[model samples]
Target: MLVKNISVVAAFVASVCIMPAQAQNNTIVVKANQLKADIQPTMWGVFFEDINMSADGGIYAELVKNRSFEFLKPLAGWTFKGKERKEGDLLILNRQDKQTNNPRFIQVNPNHTAKGDFGIINEGFRGMGIKQGLRYDFSMLYRQPAAGVKVHVELLNAKNEVIGKTTISPVATGKEWRKLEASLEATATEPKGTLAVWFEGSGQMDLDMISLFPGDTWKGRKGGMRADMVQMLADLKPGFLRFPGGCIVEGYDLSQRYQWKKTIGPIEERQLLINRWNFEFAHRPTPDYFQTFGLGFFEYFQLAEDIGAEPLPILNCGMACQFNTAEMVPLDQLDPYVQDALDLIEFANGDASTKWGKVRAQMGHPEPFNLKLLGIGNENWGPQYIDRLQVFTKAIKEKYPKMQLITSAGTDPDGERFDYLNGQLRKMNADIIDEHYYRRPEWFLQNAARYDNYDRNGSKVFAGEYAAQSDKTVSIHNKNNWRAALAEASFMTGLERNADVVVMASYAPLFAHVDGWQWTPDMIWIDNLHVVGTPNYYVQKMFSTNRGTHIVPILKNNAPLAGQDSLYASASVDKTTNELIIKLVNVSANGLQQEIKLDGVSKLSGNARHYVMKASGLDVENSLKEPLAIVPVEEQWKASGKSLKVNLAPHSVNVIRVKHLDLVSFKKAGKME
Candidate 1:
């Protein structure tokens, strides 16, 4: 039976004062017979991976081409001899002599061969997983010796079958390095593999700085981010963006850290660095490989501006340990990093007269950027973090006092340390306490109401990192876990109920490029070419985009169904359109058909717009092959009198928009009658 609002409110008030408060019995019902609400339009926000470009990492966006032929053997090798390391994998060779001079080219006879095989493998290729039928522009530097060289470039499928092949001949006596470019089309049959440059029957050849990219024709720009990729993220309508993070900012030491200055400016000068995460996982020797900061700080700011999102930049706190804990720097030695923070703020928000501000203007944006929030560090904690926070907080408060400061609390399961850290931050008057949660789905579901007991007077909360961990077999099969959905919904409800204290929130480790992921269960997963938004992405979108400025008291009728513990509803008025938006969540296994009757609102005579996110199974996800396996669908609703009955699917989120009728029209019609 549909429980009306008027009766539910009386029941809530009666239950509240008369009995002990419990999760199951905490239902509220309105007393008014008439129902009305003013719904407001919601804003959407998206997080961009910045690895090749910024912190959000993937090959397509990562700007620097790290693995070239810099490590190739000299004349002892078939292709070239005496390779001088350029950037990451870029190697330059001299062609003057073989013994005395470095041999840039090698003569490959019928029988004579080099010690190792020299052919393009997976190395040095970006966006290898790009979809077929897409156009990509390829560029590289090659020099020919006195004798010309012939090379065959083939796009091979996963099975090593050549899907597309092209041959190129370098002109004789090509001494200096010359730029060679070609446009390649990704065919429909092109399996997921590398576009290999095979040097067979080579006379003399030297190559450096090879790059291939999808064409920029889609957006009319020459080159940069893929247009379709950017458009997909833009459609999500992200509200805020947290830049350069998740262990990316917290480097081994001060030198290896992601310095904003190095990444800015032209691509030629930007030195590439080995990602700490990649280096650790690959077990490579050289950890501090220089990173070409091609997509620098300016790009991050520009991206935020372009997408109309609030920029949230994270700075390095004073922990020198690489993935381990370290002692904080002495107060005297901490000045440089602190100054770097100050300068970054100036670069983002200062006028032209300021130092970095002028540099920003020189970069084409004379106007100061809007710097809303600044995070202290990624996930390091302890006395060192606290000490560093003390220094950073003091300086930032003195300079940009209005800017919100966030500090990370260690991710300990007990949450005791987290609680203590929050207390410390509140004592220090920190603006936001960054807490990370990564637990099993069941844990999240059980603790969904954990935040209900939070101290309202304390600093705001930000769930910096969160996602369920799954085994390899389960992820590959594309199975949905109900535990995750339930946890997400429950946690989201806590955030909404405490929205006043939790002003800004975001899920961590947002994207994991198919091969690029070190952690499992990311919100969004993408390969070099194809992408998929995980179930968590949809859950986040539903809550974030439907949020309203003001929340109304919600009343529910009926005893709590066993196993279906709680229900929540909130209402808000859109001042601009005078429409009422109702967000209802039914955390139950059975569908809820409830009668909603709002009070203190009138003239409600309009069709309702309903948006629901549901799936046949809880574990369903959208993949690159099929993006619409699970998506939101909209429908129209007809209201009957002052009460509206809604049938909410089990374990589903529903947003209803009701446009309040105009009183003037009703008055005129009454007079005419």
Candidate 2:
């Protein structure tokens, strides 16, 4: 009769249907299933630096030269005393000398006989489009005959109006070069402008290696990415990464685009481009700028390999109307774009025989990279986009039939855009469809079940960009409210439930330095002084870290609990250690105390490991000043006989691991005891 009762329970679980809550009493009972746990790596994606903007004199993503100065142009009253050399047709700056005679002052002097009119006119730092309210760290080397030089700095807006001004007193010594630094705060009154480094006030000073940066702090523990940053990300054990995106792919023009080729090789040849958010311009006449592709396609692919992640590269889509989208290249003129696609593949999976593949080998690795997925473009739609996508799809499929292709269609839930594009993609046999979402926390929670009924027969899904808003201003120190935590948790549960369809997912705008951020409420916020991970980052880590490879069926028996709206459970058994891993999610405002009874297992033994995620309140958040306001904690659980009872805090997620004792012989153990 007991066995018969268990069979009936299994049948009931198979027929369980999910429905919306009518009343508050929503509860479910779960029965353990005997299945092996399949452990897989976690998926955690972030954006690497894109070379679309210039931060300081040194290009972003490019290597910093220890001591050197690259002249942009000749100043108004300055003449080049040295010969200019031409490498090919390009004019190269070699070396120039300034002839001045009025008692050349090496350092600044408050009371001097002359006004130091011999200063280099226009021989100053140019802005790379820095805007107001953003923070930046500016550093340079000042060498003079004596110390005590007053360096004047000015930030000029696009209108040529001085928006910010500051003066620094250099710690001078007459004998050697001294390092000087000043932190600049962009003001609301300052529009997008250029930065100028003025060495005025009666001093003959030699300036070199002028560096400016935005963000609260540097990324790696040391100044640059030597080994610390790599170790930190590796410790997380992420499964997959979606490289190079979140508006960095969408440039203002073709000339300003992120050309992957330029970022490779040495740093000197790479040109710096204007940042889109900084509201600054390149040299004037036209807004077109150069990007020193220091962090190129190879680096992105290598980073994925180093971190044990599956690389998912996103290509440039058809041009936008604002940035001058190239007309659908006539079928005849499509060679260039098509060739680019081919080159990208070769670079990723080509052998030494191939051109780009040979380059990869020359870069140090002789083995071909494993690349199974390729994204057609960034966020794009419309008829023109569709047509261009078709061309790319045909070419890529013809070359590599087994390769997976991912495409983007606009995300308009209310309208038929996603549905319509989904249909088209299915018809064309696309492997995956990239979907993005950025909304308020309430909306995310309200639609947590949006993918529950998604067509299983359609292409796989990828949530490319989804973030809860905190602030719209440029400052990166803003904190994410507590409501966001609850909302994100609920939405993630939905993603986990639909893992079969949602094959891959990632959060957008992964990092922002307090001084140089264009967006707010990022996952990781850093400044020149410190770095902190947001509450959302921890939530993602906990969920991804505990995920198993395969899905198992669970049986729940609870009827209805007061103040509870939904209850769910998933379980798996680790083969190596013979431990049962169980995850329980309760989306209720009140706490839940339930007893889990395992009837079939007679060999169950050992302590249980439990991990929990919860918050003190709904509106709490971790600020720059206080980053660990909310995080996950681990504890042990007591198990007696075949039943385990545990208490779950309100609005909490819990994972428990129960060890087994099949390896221990009862008779032998009893004799020993």
Could you say which candidate leads in TM-score?
1
lDDT of 1 by residue, 1-673 (tens): 1223223223322322212234333333432222222111212244333432223234234322342322232311112222232232223444444322113422222112222233544422233454567666666666566543455565667676666556665565457767777767766454255656655444555565455665653344433554545554555566676777756677766555666766666443454555655454442222222344545678767766776678878877766543553535677788888988898999998889989898899888999887868888777766667888998999989988898888887764346776677767888877877777766554454444455556656787776666554333214332334435544655665555445455666665666655545555666666655557766777777766666544444455532111133355555444456665666655555565666765554546879888887666555566777777776689997754555677877666677887763322111011000
Score each candidate by Cα lDDT.
0.56, 0.54
- Model 1: lowest-lDDT 10 consecutive positions: 664-673
* Collision count of model 1: 49
**Where is model 2 more than 4 Å wrong at Cα?**
1-28, 31-44, 47-232, 280-292, 321-332, 412-414, 470-479, 554-580, 585-587, 597-603, 640-643, 661-673
**Top-lDDT structure, candidate number:** 1
| TM-score of candidate 1 against the unseen true structure | 0.76
TM-score of each: 0.76, 0.67
Residue 271, candidate 2: how far off, in angstroms?
A: 3.4
